[model samples]
Each structure stands twice: as structure tokens, then as C-alpha cells.
Target: MDIKKITLFGRKDVKVYSDRPKNIQSILSNHLENLKDKEAIVTEEKTLTYLELDYYSSSIAAYLQKKCDVKKGDRIATIIGNRYHFPLLVFACAKLGAIMVPMNVKLSAEEMEYIINHSKIKVLVSEEKFISKVEDIRRRSTHVIPEEKNVFVIDGKNTFNKLIEPDYPLDSVTVDELDPAYILYTSGTTGRPKGAVITHINVIHSLINYQKIFQTHEDLKTLIAVPMFHVTGLVAQLLHLIYVGGTVYSMERYQNKKYIEYILKYKINFLFNVPTIFIMMSTEEEFKNSHFDFVKKVAFGGSPIYQQTFQMLKESFPNAELHNAYGATETTSPATLMPIKYPKSKVNSVGKPVPVADIKVVKENGEECRVNEIGELFIKGPMVIKEYWNNPEANEKNFTDGYWHSGDIGFMDEDGFVYVRDRKKDMINRGGEKIFSIEVEDVLKSHELITEAAVIGVPDEIYGERVKAFVVGRKLSESSIQKIKEHCQRHLAKYKIPEFFEVVDQLPRNASGKILKNKLKEIGRK
Candidate 1:
């Protein structure tokens, strides 16, 4: 591997992977011819070999091309869950140079409609469970009307099966490396979600970054334990493994017992998920007894890990390398990954920037922060998405000089390791004294009585905002709250201690396993 400078998105001297596949279609084409009959996807219902994946995806592509007139630059949307069809649609659109839009299945009809119309989708792929929502979208709006033929429903009448019957055949369509491949929407917890346009070049570089860090092999096997719509599942689990010519077992929905069973049944070696999922898996009955050392890699992100879950992972996978990868939909998947050979003292840090990634911390005055100084983190690389789809104002505000403002309050240590403290909006201001919620939450989680904790800023007349913490614990008494405050007082500064503590069963989370701070703020107001 060589480091070379190339021009990209009007940015000269951009570092990129020296030698790689031209496009995602080319990457799979190499495997399609060589790894034919090799298992590509194994679902609960069936398994698909590489050759079958190619033929079926090609058949669907041909149908869309010949019947729906879907050509290069077209947008095809999937409102389905984790299935072999999602992967099929990924390849089919890649080969045709059309964009695949994966929507959150849990979204309401109105939310789904916003994405569908905003992306100007030409075809919509969904399942029976969500067909009513799709129909509702059709009934409510006049933005885009999909033809009866263009709507490919997977469950009701087996439209996907008939479309992939091998009768429809397609010729190769010319696709460039930088052509858009997918439009993934952000989790709009506070506002409307924006579609991030990802190109083949961005995806290829991200896959290579994972390869560089994890040293991925062709024989590695992984399971999609998270939502296929999110970055962790879509980019990290599905696409990365596909790029390595590895096997992907589709888990339609995440269940703790099922995750353990698949780990044993499939001999799954690679794992990637959000920290919350791992936290729950630590409590599963099988998790304690089944000390299977087969899993070779375990990676997590989307939230900070508590002490218990981190220790359980270390004890369970003694032979595996654990990583805390941090990235957003805009950065493909991982902008930073915990290096395998890192100091145990810096476990809280999220490791250095990926080889191609450039990260900087800037203050409100637009000046770079010194080592160990907190500021907003900005990431720029070929892996970063060029812009938000059809949102010029968002593009202007979020991107600058090819860098995407991450909106994370963090600091890079003198050793180059990056530590994310909190989201800028989530930082509490107590009478002009800045308070990072993680500081208080970290101390609260360290208590033996608490299992999980989330901190937020509450409105107060005296101080603009006050610190509030929501913790999950067993039978929290009145005295328990006082003891928790005493524990925080010992470890945290006076202003950093939470002013209020509320015990709850669990914190609110999005489909991707990220804590919904906005939801927590609503709870604080009430």
C-alpha cells in the first residue's frame, strides 16, 4: 500500500487507496467469477451462493432496466429489513449505476414519505409488514407516484422471487468509481433526516480502511446483528464483509438468544454492533456459560460503553481483538478505530484517525485546539460523503473544504488518540460553567448499583441549564440516590455532579442503538 495524492471533489492532494477496485460492481465481479458456489449469504430461511447472488441480482436489475426504464443515476429505495434481498438490491443498483436508498423500517408513513419524495425515488422495494405505510404514502402525497410494476413487494405475492427467476437478463452498464451508490438517511431524532449521498469511491476507501485496521480475510464470517439501514450494519457488516469475500449471515431482527445461537451455529468470527446491544447480550443466560473463543473480532460504536459490558467482552473473547469504531453515515462507517496494539490506560479513547482520514478539533473561534483541548471534531477524506442529497443549506452548514463537521465535542490527545466527550448540543451549561454529561455519567455507571446511565441538560431559571442523569438500576431507593451523588462528588467536580438523578428501566434508543438525547430532554422537561 502506497500513500499518494490525488484530486477529489475539487480538493487537490487528497490521500486515497493506491490500488483498489474501481467500483463496487467490479469488486463483486471479481468474486462472482472466482468464488462461484461459495456461500455469500446465509439467512434463517435459506442460503445464497455467490453465483446465485449474481444471477438473482442480475435478474432483478434486468427487470428494472427493461420494464421500469431504470438506468444509470436512478434512485431505487428499499424499505425492508435485513434479508438476502437487501444485498441483492445493493448489487443490482451498483451494476446499473443507480442509487439504493435504505429507509428505517420503524419510521412512520409520513417519515418514510418524506425520504421517498425527497430522494425522488423511481422504484420502492418493501415488505408486506410495511406495504400499508407505503400505500399510505401514496394516498397522502402527490410528490411521487410509483407505478404498480415499479413497486416490488417482497412478502405478499412473492414479487421478489418472480423478479429473480433468471428470465430477465441484463448487460453490463458502465459505472464510474465516483458515481453515487447509495443514499442513506440520518436518524432525525431532533429534526428532519437528511439523505447522505455515498459514492463508490467513498465506500471502497472505507472498506480498505477496515481492512487496514482489522486485517480482514476472505474466510472471515460475520452476522448482521443490527439494522441493515444504519451505517454499522450496512457499511461495516454487509459491505465490508462482501468486499473481503466473506460470508454474511442475515439476522432479520436482533435477539440476544439468537445472536448467541448464531455465534455457535455459524462459527461466526467477526462481530460489529452498537454498545447497547453488547450490554444486553452480556446478561443473556447463554452469554456466561458459552465462552466460545471462536469470535476473532468484536467492534462497537454509536455510544460509549459501560464498565461491565467492556469487562464481559474481554473475558468472553480472550482471543479476539476489540475495537471502538467511531463514525457517522457521512463518513461511510469508521473515521476512527481503536488500534489493536494500544495502551490499556487509554481505553476510553476512540483511537487515531483512519489512514486516509484527517481529523481536527476547532473551537468556536475557528482556531485549532491544542492537545487535550475540547472542541468540535471535523473529518475529511475520500470516505466522507460529498454532500447531502438535495439539501443545499445543510450541505453548506455541515461541510467545509471537503471536511464534514462531526458536531461532536472531543479532543485529540498528545498521543494522537481521539476522545469524544459529548455532543455539542448535549453539553450542559450551569451558570456559564461547561459540564460534559459523560463526566457525570461515567462516574454514575461506575457505581455497583447502576447498570446504565444517560445525562442531559434540564432547563432552569437560575442557571440556563442544570445537570440531570437517568440511570438504570435495580430498586433504587431514596438513600441510593444520595449515595450516588456522594459517589459522583468524590470523582467529579462540584459543577459536574448531576443535580438530579432519575432511575429508569432503560434509556430511549433509536433503531441503531444510539441514545436519544432529545427524548431524554423531553423527559427532563416533564
Candidate 2:
């Protein structure tokens, strides 16, 4: 388990140190001591330096300890967006040894209720826009206190402003690195979201991964367009930036034009978002001629990127290093990253396993698959989460022998690069023929007329399941469909060709830009 050095960016070998801070609080305490006046966070409403952030978080921690009686291991949930309040609550929880549970703001009342009750959350904070949703959940869920005093809003009369006591002394608490710092719920494509228990050590390890792989340093300007609820934004962008004393500018929500404007206005040097955001921004008229000289690094994940979009980004940010990263909520943020100076010959790979992590492709019999053989991906490292919150069944099913079963189908090449094929559930079996949806989707996206594509399996009367594609395109004529079919025939097997094609103006996506294949499947059924 001793990691001495890590090779990153193709040639940079960075030393991996074992004597790091035990917890996030210690890390922040160091920053406060040395870089007190450095700007830490910038939002549309206000800016907070390291000193101010420490003061506000400690004040909030005092309020929670006195007013809410929050203690070590208590859960405080928030439905807020990417604002100063979210990070404030997070660090406050760390200081008080409370576990912060950040729920997705886009969830429906029922979904929110399920998570709130499932986690046994005590205090719930939300924004004014989502006040009604929280109210509805409070009525439905017994875990949430159905009183005005317990629920706080961001922009309304019921706010956290009154709880701030800048001069209040913070109670001393011993927090273990192994203690759970946050519980981030997975997207839960198939069922209810399961909270991934991310510990303080996991967060620190992921921060190290970002610092080593991306080569980030202090004073770096980053624009976080992704939601803070997701690991990509929380661990990779926000927390890492804070650890390095960098300035973070957050967007409440993503608008193609507004995102471009922020890049130009803030002179942001580091950009991290989903592939769909980049695709949309590259095609945006405003971004067509926008200068990207300020951008030094661009990192993308959550889903696959089309080859055409990758080429366009290369042309757009000719001076920037483009990285396609792969990880999950369970791994904190990134387990494998495509190197900054990656080989074009291995463009499809998600790069090698990070310094602190190990990856293996295994067959169903628990045996490791040979190189180039497609199988389930298993990841192991300190960065891998120890358990799922209150979900023993999921922990038992997903974790075994110090490795996390990723539930993703992929393979590693002889040179150690990983290429993901598809999620195990998304694979199609048509008349005993296995078809990977990602393969078909990749080929479909290569079509000149198609803007985006998602492939799914529809129930077939005789074949059990058949391939179907949902696409966003300019033309949907019979001739265009025929041309698409012909193109598939040239690139794919006869049985792998999509049996049905649905052309829509846009694909249904979640807040993270992951195509909701379940919604597509429901549409196919109807």
C-alpha cells in the first residue's frame, strides 16, 4: 500500500507523501494560519477569503452545536445549489464532527422525502426556490421536523443569517480521518439513490489525486459549472481549490451563454464540466469566436464524449490541456484520468489508474480477465469509499476483498490504458447476440447529421431485448434514417444495428447531463 511516486501528464513523476493532514479541518486550519486573507470562494452574491470562510464556518458550527444540538455523527442535510452556503455548511459540519448530507435540488418531493427519511436527517436547509418542495417533504416524511424553526431558507425570512456569531468560540471536537465527512447520494438510475459515505481520508486522497494529476496550484481561478452535490464538483473542484488556496467562482446553474461569459469575465483557468456542457458550449454561437487563452485545463466526465466534440475542443482551446476523467461517487471523484499529453492513438482510453488506486477487469467467476478482454471493472485504493450509508446490502454487494465492484463493463489494454464500453445494465442482448449500447451510440454520434445519441434495449417479443436509439438531430426524414441505417451497417454487425430510431429535438437528461435511459425506456414502452 506504499505509494512512493506517481507518473502523471505522461512524464511528470510526482512524489506521493504519506505524512499528510489527518482530516480536512487540519488542512483548512493550516491554510487559515498561513493564507488568511487569500480569496477562497467567489459567488454572484459575495466573496469570502480564507479568514472569512473560517470565521463564518466556525460561527455556523457554534450555532448548530448550541441551537440545533448537533453533535458528532449527526446528519445535517441541505438542498442548496452551488453557493457559498453549501461549502460553509460542509466545513462547519467537519468542524463539529457532523456529517453533511447534500441532496439533489432537482429531486421531486417524493424522492427528497425518501432520502431525508432514509438518512434520518435532523436539520434541513434549502433555498427559497425550493422552500415549497421542502415543505411538502416535511409534511410527508416523519424524519424532517415539520416546524418553521427547524427548516432554514437561503433567501427568505427563515435564513441562516441570524445563526451567524462571528465572535462565538467554537467547541473543540476530535474528528477521526476515518469518520464519515459527507454522504453523497448516487444518481440511482435503477432504484432509490444510495448515499455514498465519503470519509475525510477519502476526500484528502481525492484532493491529492487532483493536485497530482491536474498539476493545480495556489491562485488558480476555477469556474465550477457542475452541481456541488456531485462528487466532480464537490471533491475535485471546490474542496481541492480550497485546499490549494485557489479562487473558486460558482454558477447557480448552467446557461451556455452565461458559462462562456464567466470564462471571459473571470479569466477562469481551470474548467470542469460534463461532456454535454462542452458539446453545447462548443456549438453555441457566442462560444464560436470566444477566446479561450485564459483556460489552462479542461476536465470532463459523467459520460462519454464524442470524437467530433473532442476535436472541436482541441481546436477551441489549443493551448489548454484536455482531460477525460472516469470515476464514481464511490471513488470520491477520479480513479483514472487521461493524461494531459495523452497519446492520440489511445484516445478512447480513460487513461491509467491513478497513483493511489488499482484497477482490474474481472469475469463473473471472480477471475481477472486478460488484457483487451471486456469484463466488470473493480477498483481498490484509499480513494475508494469504505461503505454506503445505512445500506448494508449495497455495501455487501458492491464491495468485496478490499475492492469496489464498479458495475461498469470495460477492458484494459496491454499498455495499461482503460476503455469503458458501457454500464452492465445498459448492454443489449438481442437473440443471444451481445451488443454494447456505447458502441452503437459512438457510431451513431459519428454520423454527420446526428448531434447526440443514446442507445437502449427495448423488450422484444422473441429476442428478449432489441437495440433502439434515441437521437437529437437536424434531419429526421426517411432518407436520413435510411442513411443512418446504412452507415451502421458499414460499421456495426448486422444484429447490432438499431431496430428502431426516435429522433427528438433533445434527449432527456438529469442535472449532471447523464442521459436518462430509464426515461427513454419508458418512452419506448409507451
Candidate 3:
């Protein structure tokens, strides 16, 4: 199919097939039977067909319903890696109307405890690799203890060996479009993680947005390279592919060369990743020389894309399209997306809002700002979440007049493309992972030896950026750095861990005693 000629969105003649069912779960189940013999997911050596995915997901959902008492509206947390089973569990949970929460596997025990407790999660299904970590925190916190007696392990011995029979009559439950499908936790820039309650309509809205942005066709084969824990990974990539009956190449880990090899090997059309992944791929000589004949579009987000890097990508993938999408976990992935064709013209813009979503630049006083005026981005539509999970205080402060207050600083041009200036709050994007500096600093300050601490992001080549901690300590040394990190490892995720530590006599502060993080960034640059 000639992708360049495809300008408009949605299917003009979308003959809603007999196989395409009404509900999202039934959509997967129906498609699985329709694509029973067709290849659905491709790994390095294994290709799990639609039939296999259907069987496993059905079995898991059935097991959850019968054994684990995971009825409709119950919240289940998944702390597994990016594997086939992860999506399977996600789909299963969605099918039963259970809210699926995907935990950041790199998070420490204390961090996990905060989310588990805050969300009031029931049962947790994790990989064998992280069994010890999960078990260690299970007894420590009573936040989201399950009423279910048995905690069914994902890749463990008990009940994991059971194969789902196709003959088992699956009772399809009626699900409201507004019902919560998944609760993705955003990195709490101010405090603990806030669970963003994404509904079925929100997911559908996002997929429709993807269809509009990417111009999805029946032949589109997207690669699921991003972690399923993220909304982009689930709604933009996986669910979008399933909705269109397109193939998805799932990977457990993203080794740059190996991902490139798979792109060439399987002839993937759509590739989604962060700026870091694209930067690495662009620098590889082998990748520059390789023929990406079938690869049409490359979508990127989770961090800003530098102009230099964007120009390099244009020079490298001359034939391919690069899309710059912008959204929060609250907006069900992306409310705005830039066209792949006009990279140079729309340099720093995050494109325009998708068809169903409404975007506006608003001042601190809740009034809308004009074009090129920097203000907070406000979004209102089916895609936007109703509220933060169980946090009325946050909802009162963040959301107003039916628009989600995206804590990002950006403005729309005359053409309606958004240019992200900086984060309104101090939310750091180190590599693709989001690390709130304040969150990290709070953890570091918990140490008795540290009098004061401030965290800042410094420029990095591999991870896009790295975190640096500036401290005012009574006893600070190289050894103290390790101690601070060990302390942080207890409360924060691994990516949130500071890569560099600087012990200073006194932290640069304002007259009001506010630590000047900008000064720390400048000092770190030296």
C-alpha cells in the first residue's frame, strides 16, 4: 500500500466486518477466531498466532474469574516485563471489566507499596524474576491486599500449566463504555504516583486517534516495542493493532541492533519508540545502510525530540515518516500528533489535537491563551480521564471546567500545532522514563545524615538525560553517595535513581530558601 498518498483518517468504506465485535474484549475474542490461523505476534524465533493468544488470554481471564474472584471492577496489578503474557493479562482483565494496573518493574519496594496501597489493588500477577521483590513487599504493606485467597503467579508452577480449552463457554459480560479498563499511574511530580483512570471509551478514542494520525489500513503491521505498562504501548500500539486486525511484533527487551534486525526481518510498517531509541538507531551505521522498505511510519513521544536529532532522522530514513505525538497518561496516550511528512516545518510542535479531543492553551487563572502564548495545556473530550484515582484533592486542583489540566507548558500556533516549551512543573524525562526530581529529593531527604537535597536532570547521550543530586550534608563523601543511592533504591524506581551525586557545603538557594535547581543544572553542565 502506498502510505504517502494516504492523507485522510478513518475508513471511508469501513465495512464493519462480521468478525469485529461490539466490546473491546469481544473484539479480540472474535478476531482471534477469525484470524485463528493467521500470524498475530512475532518474536525472534517464535510467532504466536492469533489462535494461541486467544487461548491463553481466555484461560487466564477464566482462571481469574473463577479462582481469583477477579470480578467486574476489581483492580489487578501486573509487574511483568514486556512479553506476550503481559498483553494477554491486560486483555483478559479488560475483558472481565477488571482494572489492569501495570507496575514499573524497575521501581523499588517502597515505591511499589505506595501505588499498591493508593490504588487499593487486589491481586498481583508478576513474573518469576521479580517474585522475590513482590514477596518482600507483600507482607510489609496492606494497601491493596486481595480478598482472593490464592495469588496466581504468571509464569509460576501453580495453575500456570493449565491450557485453556476452546470448548469452554465464555460468558461475555456487558461493559459500559465509561467503565474503567486500566488505571495507569503517572510519575507523581509533587508526591506519590497518581493512578490515571482510563476508561473503555478513552482507549477507543485513542485508537481512533491513532487511525486518524497514522492512517491505519488493514495491512498495517505495528511493532510493540514500548513497555505495555504505558498507555502509548497499550492503546496506541497494541489495542490499535488488534482493532484493525493487524499484526504486532512484540519484544521483551529493546536491544537496538536486534530491534533493527526484526524490523528488516518481519517487514514491520509502523515502529513506535522514544527519542532515545530513535537516536541510537540513527547512529548505527548498519541501520543507516539497511533497507527499511516496508517501514512507513515511526512514532515518538515520552520525551522531547531535539531538532538536531530530528534532522538526522530525516536524512537517514528519507522514505519513512516520523510522527511526534504529545499527551499525558491522563489523555489515554496522545491527544495531539504531528504529521510525519512535515518534520522541518513543524520543528518543535507536537502537531494538533486528534479529531475527538479538544486542546487549548490556558493561563494559571483558567482562561484560554492565544496562539504562541505559553500556558498550561488543557484537554476535554472522551479521551480525557474523568479524574485521578481516589484523589479528590488532586482532582480539585488539577482539573477544572471539564478539562484535564496537563502540567505541560506549551502553546498552539495559528495552524494549531503545539510547541512544548518546558514542563510547567519540574518533571524530568531521563531517557524515556519520567523521574520527578521533587519525588527523588523527598526520598533522599529521608536520610538522617542529609540536611538538604535537590535533584536535577543533566544532559546524557545514552539515556537522553541523567539525574543529579545536590546535597548539603554533615558527612558527605563518595561512600555517602552510595548510601544515598541505596536509600533511594528503597523508595524510588531504578530510573528515578540519581546517576550523579554532588555534596556541597551549601546548596544554592533563593532569598526564600528555595533550592535553585536551574543553578544545579548549570553546575552539572560544567
Ranking 1 against 2 by lDDT, winner: 1
lDDT at position 382, candidate 1: 89
All candidates in order of lDDT, best leading: 1, 2, 3
Stretches off by above 4 angstroms in model 1 are 477-479
What's the best-to-worst order under TM-score? Answer: 1, 2, 3
Per-candidate clashes come to 0, 0, 0
For model 3, residues 1-526, the per-residue Cα lDDT tens digits are 1111111112122111122134567557667556777777675446777787777777777777776667889888878766776767877787788888888776777887788787777777777777777677767754445543545555656344442433344566677766888888876535687888887867766776787678876577877767767777778888888777788787777777888887787788887777657756765778988877567777788766655557766676667788888887888888888864563678778888776666788987878898888788887766778678998888888776667888787789888788776566556778787675646766786786775677788888888788888887667777878878889899898888988888898776422123556677779999
lDDT of 3 at 79: 81
Q: lDDT scores for all predictions?
A: 0.87, 0.85, 0.72
Report the lDDT tens digits of candidate 2 across residue range 177-261: 8899999988888788889999898888888888888888885889888898888889888998888778889998888899899
TM-score of each: 0.98, 0.95, 0.76
Model 3 Cα displacement at 173 (Å)? 1.2
Clashing pairs in 1: none
Candidate 2 collision pairs: none
Candidate 3 deviant stretches above 4 angstroms: 1-22, 29-34, 44-46, 142-149, 156-159, 163-168, 340-343, 427-526
Candidate 3's C-alpha lDDT?
Answer: 0.72
User: Worst lDDT window (10 residues) for model 1?
Assistant: 160-169
